[model samples]
Target: MKVSMGVHQLKMEGPYLTALRESNDIREDAAALQARMEEDGYIFIRGFHDRNQVQQARSEILNQLHQSGRLAPDADPEAGLVGPDNKSAFLGGTNTDKPAFLELVNSPRVMNFFTNYLGGAAATYDYKWLRAIATGGSTDAHYDIVYMGRGTPNLYTLWTPVGDTPIEMGTLAILLGSHRWEHVRSTYGQMDVDRDRTEGSFSRDPLELIEKYGGRWATSDFEAGDAIFFGMFTMHSSTVNVTNRIRISCDTRYQLASEPVDGRWIGKKPRAHETALEAPLKTMAEAKKEWGLA
Candidate 1:
């Protein structure tokens, strides 16, 4: 079982940060955006990516893996893919370059919205190279901060699905009110997780807890260009790819106005007493901040 932590530093630095800092038009209404996010735990913007671009990305990854012999034979018998649902094939960050994957990131719409949420005070903290798994029910429920310690007043995640996500199918499902992990920490408690489980595999209790809480599951049906942003501490999991198609997605992480502890990436083990994420917890203070919303 090989465990590889992703690149532990920011990608958008210097000029990029300057550009991000300068681009103020990305967010149309900061106050409204923040309000909606707080109420819904997530905000969806549709038709951000075109259909043809999405198909091209899917083809490029599949072809690369096939030519490299990484794809298996007897995948999809009908489509000439290696196995049913092309079980033998998958590609992620290492196999693709940053420029080619712009459709996944570098969207002004995405960057701008998050920039406002970050108070124009965020820096690119880290990125998870994209990973594609064979089609099946292989996802487990987990939080993003499990790998990176939850820091600052706000830590966020942007989940960009490379294609149309099926309703209640193999799509990212977030527990709506789970954004404030601290609130539920005592209620649900924590568990000891194995490294394998931390990777692409799923955990058994995610579903069990979903049933126990009478909690609702919400799936993202984003167009190729659209992206879903949520708090890093948000409880989320993916549905099994029960359909006969492939599911492709990539994610990025950001920090809002909080300082990174000692300039190091904190892991899930040896949980901390309190994270730097306390600033935003003050409802009145947060609400008082002028988002220029008037």
Candidate 2:
């Protein structure tokens, strides 16, 4: 199967990415789920959430976007259409702040999934992030740690599709066994987005990733309730959306409540943060002191 990714075409067979293994027994065998996550770097939970709930949240989000004049007036709310005047880059961070979106991310079903899966209570970062990936806009390859490494290193990201997402809609994909790449992890994974002037990505090109990293990229046609959970060090990215309709999804991070939390995303409102490249700048004197150059 062929899929579009940021205007690039990727065949699903061969070096691209094969189907990922599903954890059918995740509910019954927590150890098995952990083992799979440890080895494969991710776990794909099919229909783990209620489809109806996901749709309701999706409707709420689309309605808000439509009201904000971000979505196309003529398009169906469910379609999440954006007008031609809108760039395919349309997405705002505020959607996650909506009550509807909050309910979706903080739903009992999701909390239970983490609590059971982690064998303990899980506290999520209050910032529930939602994205409407317009056509031509896709996430670049990057590990999650660099963006939020200030908190516990054990943090896990839970990603859920707001609506039924087809391959053409550009679902998220994981790089097979990326967490095990000690060379990459020790180097790139150690660089925090807030401290390093980096994009936090290994690469944006899937072909280059496979050629250099020796791992196939894997994704699926996701149903509304389907979710994927991966650790902080795992490498992942999104496929491109070829369709005119915007694809919607939300992600939240969970860690043991006992662990230290990153304060930025957990408050009533996150402080305006510098860009990844801007936050790492240091003056020569400060840098020299840190390096003991003086």
Best lDDT goes to which candidate?
A: 2
Clashes of 2: 1
State TM-scores per candidate: 0.63, 0.89
TM-score of 2: 0.89
Most accurate candidate by TM-score: 2
Report the C-alpha lDDT of model 2 over 179-231, residue by residue, as the tens digit: 99887777777776566655555566777766766888889999988989899
Which ranges of candidate 2 are over 4 A from the true structure?
Answer: 88-97, 275-294
**All models: lDDT?**
0.48, 0.77
Query: Candidate 1 residues 68-182, lDDT tens each?
Result: 5544554632232334335533332223253456544654655665677767755444334354545454356666554454345366677767666653235666665666545
Model 1 scores a TM of 0.63
